[model samples]
Structure formats: C-alpha cells, structure tokens
Target: MDPNANKYLLFNKLSSQDAKKKLESETFKRTTLSFYKYVNLKDISFYRDYLYREWDKLKVLGRVYIATEGINAQISIPNYNIEKFKEQLDNDIYLKNISLKEAIEEKDFSFFKLIIKIKKRIVADGLNEIDFDSSKVGNHLSAGEWNDAIDKGAVIVDMRNHYESEIGHFKNAILPQSETFKQELPMVKELLSENKNDKILLYCTGGIRCEKASAYLKHNGFRDVNQLHGGIIDYKKQLMENPKLENKFIGKNFVFDERLSEKISEKVISFCHQCGSKCDMHINCKNMSCNLLFIQCKKCKEKFKSCCSTECKKIIDLSENEQKILRQGSINKNRFNSHRIIN
Candidate 1:
C-alpha cells in the first residue's frame, strides 16, 4: 500500500519531540492489544482492504498482517472505540473468540500510523500445515497453571530468540541460541532430545510462537507439551493483579515497539554487547547501514553515542552521502559481530 496516500502518514523523518507533541494533543487513551487466529482465508486481499477501511475510520495506528493461513495484529485503538472495535471483531466469525492480549502498560503512542500488509504467513514458522498437525496441539496453561507446572519441575523452554530472552525470560528456562523461530524449533527439540515424554513447557513474547512450536513438538512424538496462555505480557498482568504471585521471569521483556522493552522485573540478565557491563538496555546502532539491535549500558551509550561498535560510531562522522555510498555495495555488517572485526 502507498502509505503516502494517507494524510496521516504524509510526514517523514519526524523527531521524537514532534511525535510526542502529536500524541499529547490526542484526547483519548489508546489501548494496545494483539490477537491472531490460524484459519484458512482465500479472500485475503478483500479481507485486507476491508480491515484498512474499517480501522482507518476508528483512527487506529499499528501493524497488522494477514495471510491465507491467519491474521496477526498489534494495534492501538481509541478507548472510546474499544467496544466498537471488539464488536467489529466479534462480528467476523474469523476473528470471533480470538485471544486478544491487552498491553499491561497502555501507552497512547504505541504506534504512529496504521499499516496492514498481506503476507505469505502470519507468524512465518517456515513450515507448511503438512509439516505438523495443528489440529492436535499442546495444552494451554493459564498464568497460575504455568507457575504450577514450572514448580512441578516441567522442562521450561523459551521460544523467543536469543536477543529477546537475553534481557528477560522465565528463570531456569532453557534458552535456545538461535536467531529465528524457524531455527529455534530444531534447536529446542535437539536441546530437549532426551525429555520427549517429560512435561515440556514452551513460551514466547506472545503465545503464538508456542502454538506452532508446541504443535511441531507434538507432531515429533512428544507426549506432554504446554504453553503459557498469553505469554509474558499476560503473565505480567497476572503478577500485577496478585502481588503475592512469584515472578520467575526477570528483566525487561523485549518488545517490537518504540519503547523496545517493558520492565517486568528488577533483575538484568543481559549485558552491554559493547562494554560487557550488566545491562538490559537494547539499542539499534545509530549508523543507518549498521542498525544492529544490541544491548548497551548507560556508560556505553555515552561512550559509543548509541552505536553498536567503534566503527559504527565513527561512521556518524562521515557525510550522509559518503555513508550511503559505502552502504550501497556492502552487506549489512551488523549481521555479524561488528566489534569482533579486526579492522
């Protein structure tokens, strides 16, 4: 879709100050929520257009993806439009009974503009329906049930990538070292190769990844499998409601938003990738060509000017034209360890 076609998205390269000013001017509280469903939809194009037109009127702002397999959305709807939005969703059989996860911390500016795109798959598990039996998946555990299962010594595994789990994760959970959910599945299965029959627990940022992962594990002949119903976001809400509940997860829960993460606990399980200091502050490199998402401590932020490495920091001194010229021919250096480069 042509984003520029919309008046709301006419501006570009806006400063945070400008963005905050716009957000502050808004009168209503924006509720952030996400939901997904794995159902066949042959008319995805029509469905996409229908959603865009409907949500646009409600002045929604967030990212949404729909595919033949399913729909996944994380968006901010106006407080007044909450019931209307829910009603609209309920009106559609495809979206009916979908598990919508509300954000614990409702920031009005979770998104700047709305964007709904059509994709090949909602979650991109890198596997077709033929690869696994989604019909018979793992057990869904509530926050209370999840804690109980963990206490019972079930083998807990984090389904999120290393970058996400590095900052915050359920304590004593087996964290896979892979970068994507596609890679993490096999990594996790191999990691727990010995515990096929044992009660295996899985979780992700949202519960969606676990849905696919659990199904895959079950297809591979793992008898007992379970997933946290709403993932960490729901788990945090449960802890907040009942202060007496034990929060095994620590540090910030990495989120895909302007905030980057939300503070779930006091512990910092990760460190600054540059200075090796204990920190959970995730920052993208200031260099446009090397926007590597890595953890940086306060001191390192000051030291490197929010860049991932010394080379990236130096790149900022060059003219924009020069930087672009350099970026044109080279692969993204951030994908590899920038700090480890001998140059």
Candidate 2:
C-alpha cells in the first residue's frame, strides 16, 4: 500500500468545525476503551469483515486486530452507542462482557479511521499454541493490590519491548534486554525461574499482553503469578482519583500512536541514549523511508537532524530517486544499524 495515498484514510485530523459538530450533535460523550482476548477464532477474516461493517455503521473508530489466536482492540464509541456496540460484541459468544480499559485521557476524536486487520497472533509473540495457553492465564490484581505486592518485595517485570520500557516502567521493575515481545517471555522466565514460588508481578501498556504472558509463566512452573487488572491505563486513572497515590509509577508510559508517550508522573527516569543528556522525548526517524522509533536527546537531535543516527540522516539527504532504489525492501533491512533505535 502507498503510505501517502492512505494517509487521510489512516488518520483523519478533524477540523475545528467537525470537532464542534461531533460534540454538539452527539447525544453522549464518547469513551475510549481497549481490550484483548487470546482464544482460537474459527475464521479471522470473517470476523474482521463482520466487525468492520458493524462498527462502521455505529460510527466507531480505533484500531482492531483479529487473528487465529484472538482479538485485540482499542476503540472509541459514543455513550449512546455503547450498548449497541456491546450487543455487537456479545453476538459472538467469545467476546461477552470482556473487561474494557477506558482511556485515561479521552479526546473528542482520538481516531478518525476504523481499522480491522487480520494477523496470525494478536500480540505478536511469534510462538505456537503449545508454547503458551491463554485459557489458563495468570492472576489479575487491582492497582491497590499491585502496589501492595510491589511493597512486599514481589519482583515486577516490565513485559514490553526495550523501547517501551525505556520510556516508562515501575520504579524498580526488571526489564528484559529484548527488542520484541516474543523474546521477552522466555527471557523473563529465565530471569525469574529461580524464584518460582515468589510473588511475581507483570504489567504492560494496556494489559492485553500480560494476560497471556502470566499464563505462560504459570505453565512453565512459576507458582505465583499476577498481572495488573487493567494495566497502566487503569493505574493512571486510579492515581487521578487519589492524588495521594502518586509516585507509584516512576516515568512516562510509551504509546503506539502519534503521541508516542504519556506522562505518568513528574519524575524523569530515562536519559537520552545518544548524548547522555536528561531527556525523554521519543521520536521516529525523520526519514520517510525509515521511520524507526527511538529516543534522542536535544543535542543528538540537533546533530543528527532527527534521524536515528548519522547514517539515517545521510540516507534522508539522498535524492528522491536514489532513496527509492535504496529502499527496495531487501537493501534497507539492516540500514539503520543502531541498537539504540531498537532500545
């Protein structure tokens, strides 16, 4: 697919008039909620098509993925249409009343497009069914309970990628030195295998990954396993409800969308990887051909011109035609050549 051709379809930056009209004409405010389930789906393409048609009619917007493994969704819907949407979900026996995590920061139009893509796995673990059982998942803990576990010396592991963890994580959480979600699972198991019976706490951006992860850990003979009830999104809401509950989370929470990240607290826990400067700004490569996401300090940003490194900056400086030939897909595989970009 041409990136430029689908830019408007992928994201609709609402005009002021559209935003005002949505607010005024809609009977109730919209809520952003996310949820995921890891179960065998008979036909992923059929499910995707059904959801696309059903949600489009209800004016729903957000990203959704259906796979042979299960479904993961981050959606926004008007309050009036909430019941209808729930009905649509419940129409399928597999998705009845699944707990949904409401977004901490609700925007009028957070998503302009309703995307439902089919994939092999919902969370991209790259593992077969025998490796992990989603049916026998881990213990779910509330925010307050999670805090108590942390206070009681439970080893907390950030079950996300290196880059996501670099931006924000539990104050003293153990982070795996892995780039992809698939690698983090076994690495986490090895790191905590010695303390099988010890209380183990796990958390991710929206709690979807942790669901299956906790199960995998338990299946591997870890006796005590627990996960955040609604993940960090819920934790943030709890903090807002009680200002006294601040400082539990130490840094920013990385998000997948354009926002890149959201501030969990005033504390800055991460430094720029390139310049060793105090910074938490996560930016993708300015090069259109290689938009690899990474964190860079202001000094490094000035030097590299917002590219991942000098090499990427040089690539972007190439003429349009030359850049096209360089990006023929195979040649660009290892071009960025920076571990910092992955971290």
Candidate 3:
C-alpha cells in the first residue's frame, strides 16, 4: 500500500448530490452539533487531516473551519458513533472537554458530506489578530443571567448579520445593519459609542463570533462586556432544560443549514421580501447564475419559482443552452448581497 495513494483518499470524492443520496439511504440517525475553540494550532493542516480521517471513520458530515487561531465546526455525527466521537474529542489534546452545542431543531440531513478547510481566521472580523487578544473575551453569561441583564437595561447587541437578526433575535437587541462580521464589528462600536461604560451583551449563531466581538469591544475600551455563554443555540438548549428562565428571544433563530431557521418563539417578527406577508422562511434563488438569498412566503415562492426577481425568473425559464450562454462571462453584481437591490 503506497502512502501517497491513501493520502489521495483524504478528501470526499462524491459530489454533494450523490452524498445527499447516500445520506438518504442510510438507516441510522445523526445528531447535529457545533463547537469552537480559540486555542493556537501550530500545524493546522496536520490537525485538519487528522480530523478528516477520524471523523470520516465515524461517518461525520458537516462544515469545519480551522485556522491558526482556532477551530470552528458544525457537524452531524451518527447517533451510534456519537459516544465514540465524543471520546475522540476528549482524547484530542486541543479539543479535550470543549463545550458542544447541539442543534435545537436537528434534521437527519443537516449536512450531506464532511468539508474541512483551512482559513485565515475561524470567524473573520478583519481585525489584526495582534491588535486584540481573543482570549480576553467578555464575561460569559447564562440564559438566566442574560435575561437578568436584559431586565437591568444592559445593552444587547446581536453579533450576526442583518439578515440573521431580521428573522429572530433577543428582544431589543441592537441589531447592526451590516451583512458580515467584518463590517458588523466597527458598526457595533459606532452604534454603541456612547455606551462604552455601560454593560454590553453580545451574541451570534454560535459563540464563535461573539468570542471575537466581545474581545474586540473590550480591546476598544468597552466596560462590563459580556456575551451569551454558548450563543443562541446553547441559550435555546438552556431554555429547554430549564423552563423557569424567560425566553427573551423572539421569532425563528436563523441557522446556516438546510432547515434555514429554527423556531425559538412562536412570533414571526419578519415578513416575506416580496409580498410583505408574515414569513421568516429564507431561501436562495433557484437561478444558479444569481443565487440571491432572501425570505419568501409560500405564495411568493410558488409565484417566483424560487427566483429572486422577474429578470432572474426569465433567465431560469430559458433553455439550458440559452442559460449557459447568458452565464458565460456574465457579471451578476447582485449574486448574493443584492437581493433587496434587484427586488
């Protein structure tokens, strides 16, 4: 057996569609969970390869980002092998006893295949790593403490994108309009410029973004910085485990998965982008050439055929060859961010 031959098997060979088919044919259930750590990794590739090999053996499938700063992962593991997977983590030097936040609304196929990639940072804030110490993050708060802080008039800031906060967030959170974490950090600072001395609470989909955000705030001289210990996912888990705690969060919690978003509360705080009807369901435009992501009600979904605009709808209606011709060297300025612009 040649070592290089086995090295070629490190990556997933199956296409996403085939991987989905294989996932559907599986008989066992899988659990979706997420975790992140800001520990230094000297050899990122070595660890990445190690994780891919080990997790592939356990039939784990999901997205994982590894950087010199840390690792951020959202993965689905086979229920039968979950214990063994946990054992594997426990044995690992870097990830031992790391906190894991299970998905609140888990689907059998949250992800189709495993994908581990190296990145510059686990959660990109665009801030120089040397400028801020990520380890000096804000004070961690539990669900009960978070509610108490809210009741006490602490400044609540949603660390996620504008689209995420549009669907659901803690009531009265200072939701920044920026679309990415890199833009949100400075926007958040400006949004709370006067509240530097005030108690500020930050949170994201998982705790990873907040970990960086809280540190950034602290570095920028914000006093009394705090964050949801495990972000919204863990907050929901805490709420489920303890009903006495008040659920300050409203509407659906937007997620980066096939399910799109999970119900955190019964309230629908957002409306469809097209008809303005009450809806929190998000979907990417069906037109591969212009995959704009936006909220669409069932009616609008059927009417538009999952396209974001009439122009996109016309393009999708064209023959395959015609569509190909249009796609050739075509520049879609509104490919992802301009759903509102095109609409």
Candidate 4:
C-alpha cells in the first residue's frame, strides 16, 4: 500500500495570493493550455478526485470543471513535466488523445492553483438536455476551412459574451450583446432568424459554447451550421504554424487569465470607457464592493487610481474598517452587472 495515498485532498488548500507567490518563485517554465470534450462520464466525483490527485502530483495549476456530460479544462503545467502530464492524460480513458490548445502569449502565468469543480454542465447555457441535442452539433471546420468560409461570405457570429467580443473578434462577426451564454443563445437565434437558411459560422473563446449553440440552432431548424474547429485559440495556433494564412481577427483576444487578453492582430477596435481613446484593456474596479469589470486606459487608470469611476475611487479611499461597514449596508447600484460597452 502507498503510504501517501491520502496525502492530497480533493480541494486546493492554499490561498490564491499564496499560490500566486509560490508560482512566481518557481524556477521552471510553465505552459498554459486548454481542452474540452463532450463525452459522458459515469462517476464525475470519482474522476474529479482522481484528476485532482494525479494533477496535483505533477504541479499542475488551472480551473477544471467536470460534469456527467463532459469535462472542460484550462491549465498550466511545468515544461519539464509536460510529457509526463501528457502520459497521464494518455493513460486515462476519458482524456486520452485530447487536443490541447497552447496560449499564444505565455509570459504571464494563467493560474496559480489547481481547482477541480463539479458542475451540472461543463458550459452553462441555462438549458435542459432536451433544449438541444449536443450530439447533433455543427460541422467542426479547420482554421483554413473557416478562413475559406469567411472569404465565401458565410454569416459569422461571435458565440461569446459582449465583453469577450468587445476586446477582440473576427472582422464583421455578428458580436452578440448578451451578458451570458444563456441569454446570448436565444438572442443570437433571433438575430439571425432572417439568415437561417444561409451558411452560419460560429466561434467563441474556445469551442465549448459553440458546441451547444450550434446544436441549439440546428434544433431550431437552422441549416448549414458550422464552427471553428477549436475556436479562436486553435485558430491562432493554426495561423502561427502556417505563415501563409491571413489573420482575420482584430485586436487582443480576451482570455480568462492573469494576462487579460492575447494579441491576435495589430489592431485596436475598442476604446477606453473613460476617455474614449483607442484601447482594448479590461480592468476591474479597485473598489472591492464595486468590482465592475470595464475597459480603462493607462491615463484613466492613473487618474481614477484603477477604479471604474470617481464614485468607486472615493469608496476605495475610505479606511478598511469604514469600507467593511459600507459593504455590509450599501447596495452596489452603481456597479454594472453586465459589461460596460462604451463604443
């Protein structure tokens, strides 16, 4: 029997700050990557715990969600242990031969700790299983094929939230204005009702949302539904590998990491929320109570002291104790629940 069988727990023990400090002090380089699959699992809890134990041994760090339907993962692993990590995945039945999408910009670490969560679904779209048959998804087009489709004037729809698209998206892509996937799914359906019969190309940060979305559209009777093979991340990878391919995406691709976005092209389509200057940087308000994620320019960041507004700046100025009291009683009416789209 292994003496340290129970040494690792199913949950992360260190605080995020502490974990980040540990990661910064690490000597070896780490690679950030993401992958997902819509495969069925008999025991999600067992698989989640098994993965946590195994990955923790390899010093892996990132967010992973496992459900009965599937598993979605975004993680960073030490360069030295990448092969070992791959071997671990290969040995596993569920994750074997899973395609990994490496981050374009790896200067900043994506995560500091490993977190395996059990959710009802891998990608939440606020729908029952009956809403859309996941098995009947759109055609997965390769990066080159996607480009060809775009050249052929196929209807392109950005299957991401407003914030995700506001930072970066393909040129002329139908950027949905919804806050969540649940809302965006129906909104997108109606937005393209007129073009239901046309060839539709859908994409997102990764291909998870589009997997569900494409099926939803097909269930609703849309014809010729197709999606970017592995979404923008994979598209960027394909473009990097092949120099001849033209990069159609503009501005930074908004990523859920310490490095907020990655450069897809040398273009800035969005502007600063405060000054209206050409900027695509997204920042959360310094005020903990009003932690609204919005775009701020370098000038406004300095002027507002990394806050969303003068009001939030004032709150941040208060003493820690005073701020606690305000948080206890005050309502965050000024905070924008959805992203602030300052176009």
Candidate 5:
C-alpha cells in the first residue's frame, strides 16, 4: 500500500447537529467498543471474509486481527445499530455473549474504514503455544478489589509496552523497561521472583493480553496472581460508578486508535522528551519516510514542526520525488528503531 494513498482512515471532530447545516442532516451517533476472544479457528480466511462483508455493510469501522489463536477488535457502531451488531456477534459461537468494553467519551465517528488482517498472534507477544497456556487464564478482579489488593501490598505490574505505560499507570506500578509487549512476561517474572507469595496484579490496555499473562505468572511459581478484569477500560467505568475512587488511576490510557490516548484524570504523568515540560501528548514523526513516535511539547512542536530529529526535519523539506526515491524500500529497513523516544 502506498503511504500517501487512501489506505488510512480518519474520524472524530464534529459540530453539534443544530450548530451546522451539514451536521444537522447526519442521523447516526457512533459508539466505540472493543472486544477480543481466544479460540482455535479452523479457517481464518473464511471468518475474515465473512466479517469484512458483514461489518462493511453495517458501517462499522476500526482495526481487527484474526489468527489461529483468536481475534482482537476495536470498532465503532451507530447507536441505533447496537442491537443488530450484538446479534451479529451472538450468532457466532466463538464470540457469543463476549464482554465488550465501551469507551467513556463517545466520538462522532471513531473510524472511517474497516481493516481486518491475519497475523500470527492477536496481541503480538511473540510467544508460541508452548510458551503460555491461554486455557488456564488468570483471576479477574474488579476495580474495588484491585484497589484493595494494591493497598495490601500486591506487586502491581503494568503489562503494556513502555510507551503506553509512559502516559498512565497505577501509582507505584512496576513498569518493565521494555519497548515491546513480548519483553514484558520474562522481565515481570524476574522482577517478582523474590516475592512469590505476594499478590501480583497485572493490567493492560484491554484485558486481552493479561488474560494469558497472569496465567503465565502463576505457572512460573507466583502463588498469588490476579489481573485487572477488563483492564483499564473496565476500571474507568467502575470509577465513574464510584466518584470516591477517581484518583486510583493516575494518567491517560494510550489507545491504538485515532483518539491516541484517553484521559482518565487531569494529571499529567509524562513529559515532552524534547522540552522537559509536563506533557503527555504523543505524536508521530512528520517525516513521512520516518514516522517515529515521540513526545513534543507545544513549544517544541512549533519549533521542530513535528519532525523527530534534525535529520528528519531536513528530509521533510525534500521535494516529493526526492522523498519518494529516498523512502523506497525504507519502510522495512527499520530506520526509526533508534529514534523511539521511550526508554
């Protein structure tokens, strides 16, 4: 797919129906929800084709992945079509009655297109079947219970990647100094090796990854292992139910979609890497050739013009033809590996 082609989707930002004539004619209101299930599928291509055709007709949008292991999805649906969407999933044996995490703030349109791709693993932990057993999953804990465990000195471990954890995490949560999800398991086991009897609580963006991860910890001799049921999304919902526990989670939850990250509280836990100022905003490199992830302060954003580095800034100024030739075959060459701002 050409990077400049209409291969991507855009959504969000809308005016009230009464405020604009263009918006007044729109009838549907969208809701963003995510769900995942780990099941052995006989034919993934068949399932993929079936879902793409069905969902595209329903005007659903978001990225979805299917593998022999299972399926992971983040999708937006029109409010009136919610029942129809649920019925569609319920009709499938593997996805029937699955718990879906609803977003706190609903956007106009969360996604502009539907993308379903086949991959080796749903969450990209890079672990083979022998490495972890998805069948013997972890103990699921609700928000109040999770808070109780934290107070009782449970070793809270953030199960997300470093960049995701940078924006928000539980207070004093032990973050593995890892850039990828694949690195979290062994590193977490090593960190909690001494406290085998201590309650080890794990959490991730959605509850998908930790479902297997917590099981992996118990397999490694961690006696008391538990996980945040439904992960941060569920926690946020529980927090809304009880205003007293508002401060439990400290920062924004980094999302993979267009919202980028969702704010849980007003507190800012991360700083702009370039200016050393308090800012948790994450942006991709403006250099189309190198879309490195970095945090740029509003001041630095204006100064650097959203480029990751001086070299990238110069590259961004190049002519379209010159940039195209330079970028040829660079997509798979790992040019942005060293430029990742997360430690």
Candidate 6:
C-alpha cells in the first residue's frame, strides 16, 4: 500500500504500535540493513517519493534519508522479498553497486514503518562543503586490520557521543564528552592536536559518522588516519565468524532502535548512573518532561520506576492533570534524541 501516494507523511496517521503489530505477524521474516554513499542526487523529492512507493511494495520498513550528497538508511526488508529489494536497488543507476550492511543482530520489531524524506545532508556534521573533500576519506580497515593496528599502538578513538560511549566502547579509545556530532568534530581535533602526526583510528555505530569524521580530521592536517570498514556491527559479525579474533571491544553497543543495544562481549564496562552498580542497560527516564537517556540497573529501575532521578521520579508520580501542566513549558525529551531527528 502506498500510504503517502495522495498526501505527505500519510503513514503518520497510523498508530506506530498498531503498524508494528501487523508487521510482526507477517509470515515472512524481516532482515534489517543499513548503507550509505556519497553520490550526488539532483532531485531529492523524486528520489524520496520513488523509493517510498517501490520499497513499500516489497514490505520494507525502517527509516531512509536522501540528500544532495547521498543516502543513509536503516531499513528492514521482508525475507521473501529480499531479492526483489536488491534487484531494484542494483538496477537503479545511483544506488547500483552500493554496499549494504545487514544487521548482525535484529529483532522482529526493529522498525514498523517505511519512511523516505529529503534532507540537507545525509549525515549532519556541521561542516561546509568547502571544508573537506568527502571523496578523500580515510583508509578502510577490516576487523582483523583494525585489531592489528590497535595492538601495534594506534591511538583509537570512539566517534560516538558521551551517552553512547558510557555503555560500551573499545578499550583505550578517547571518547569525547560532547553529545552531538557537530560538537564532537572540534573536540576531537583539540583532543588529538598534539598527536596529529601519529596513527589515528576511528569507529562508530555503523561507520557513517566515521566516514565524515575521518575526512574532517585529514582536512585538519592529521596524518595516517584509518577507520573500521563497517563499524561495530561488522566487527561483531567478524568475531562471531572467527573465534580466534579476540574481541577487544567490550560491553554492549548502543543502537538506534527499540532494542537500544546489542551485546558484543560478555564483559560489562560501565556502571549504572543512579546506583553505581556494574550495568550497561540504557533506559529513558519515565517522566515525560525529562526523559534523559541513561544507564540503569534492574534494581535502580525498580526503585525509581524507570525515572532517571528523584526530580523526574516525583514528576512521573504526580496526577495526570498536574503532569500535563508541567510539560507545557518544558522540553519533552520523552523520545530518543536520534529517533526524533529522523522522524
């Protein structure tokens, strides 16, 4: 069904929960995948509208964004229609030969709707086109190569934000404190300013951020920069395929979905912010007014009823009337920051 054939964002009318349940009950399984490229797209609207109509027929669900530069998508293709989806993509001149990374770990409800929209840039890094040459990105290192470089003393850096790194990251990686990628760009420059000539390694959730980040670093006169070929998702797949590939990356990897996280190693590297116990599970505060995302343990989750702090806990405990009034003037962080931006 072409939900948006007659209007804009027609799928928004459907209840997300309702659509999710329908997709879950389908006979065929769902295969979650993501990919990106730096090709120039002329008509953003035509590209977006065409994909929405065609992909929807194949029972594809998930988010997709097309910009003047390229596309960034985290989509789920129905098992039966996987070949059809691929065939259509390969046939398209712009999308042909693009790499698609399948999720190493995916749930049935990873996504529930199909959305395609036009954006300014595929990944917003707050960089002008004149600043860096996107074509001249860093070297792409495989899982084995990345591991070897780290073993040989390459300065590893986590390209994700502080909240993401708090749950899990490769050991000895320099994780900046900034929340957004825009802020992270300059912060990384300053953190490694003195060692600009040394070997620098970067990795993110799915490699998109690292692609842009590596280029930015190189533009800033950094020498010998490298990035994981497919980010942590590919790294985990490699470890599973080869038992001898000692998993240097510890703890859960923060994801942008209902699953929220995927475990890479058995080791827990972070403590719950509320109780300080060894935990890596992330939960949003229950209070709609202040739904800050933070790591929380089972004990703390139960004690605080899933709220982040005492202030938020009290707000959630109030009557519905009072809670609504309080939310009128406050920023409603009830949704995940990443999900909100795409939607």
- Clash number for candidate 5: 0
TM-score of predicted structure 4: 0.93
Q: Write the per-residue lDDT of candidate 1 for residues 4-90, one digit (tens) a residue.
A: 676443222456567567767898788888787888877888888888888878877778889988898988888899888888888
lDDT of each: 0.81, 0.77, 0.87, 0.88, 0.80, 0.84
How well does candidate 3 match the true structure, expressed as C-alpha RMSD? 2.2
| lDDT for each residue of candidate 3 in 66-152, tens digit (9 for 90 to 100) | 999889998998889989999999999999999988888874368887889999988878898777687898999999999999999
TM-score of each: 0.88, 0.80, 0.94, 0.93, 0.87, 0.90
Better of 2 and 3 by lDDT: 3
- The regions of model 4 sitting more than 4 angstroms off are 1-7, 328-338
RMSD of each: 4.1, 6.1, 2.2, 3.1, 6.1, 3.9
Candidate 3 residue runs with Cα over 4 Å from true position: 1-4, 329-342
lDDT of 4 by residue, 236-273 (tens): 98998998999999988888776778988988988899
Give the higher-lDDT candidate: 4 or 6: 4
- Runs in model 6 deviating more than 4 A are 1-10, 318-322, 329-334, 338-343
In Å, residue 324's CA in model 3 sits off its true spot by: 3.1
Worst 10 residues of 1 by lDDT: 334-343
- After TM-score superposition, the amount by which residue 228's alpha carbon in candidate 5 deviates from its true location, in angstroms, is 0.3
The order of the candidates by TM-score, greatest first, is: 3, 4, 6, 1, 5, 2
In candidate 5, what residue range of length 10 has the lowest lDDT sum? 7-16
Which candidate has the highest TM-score of all?
A: 3
> In model 2, how many backbone clashes occur?
0
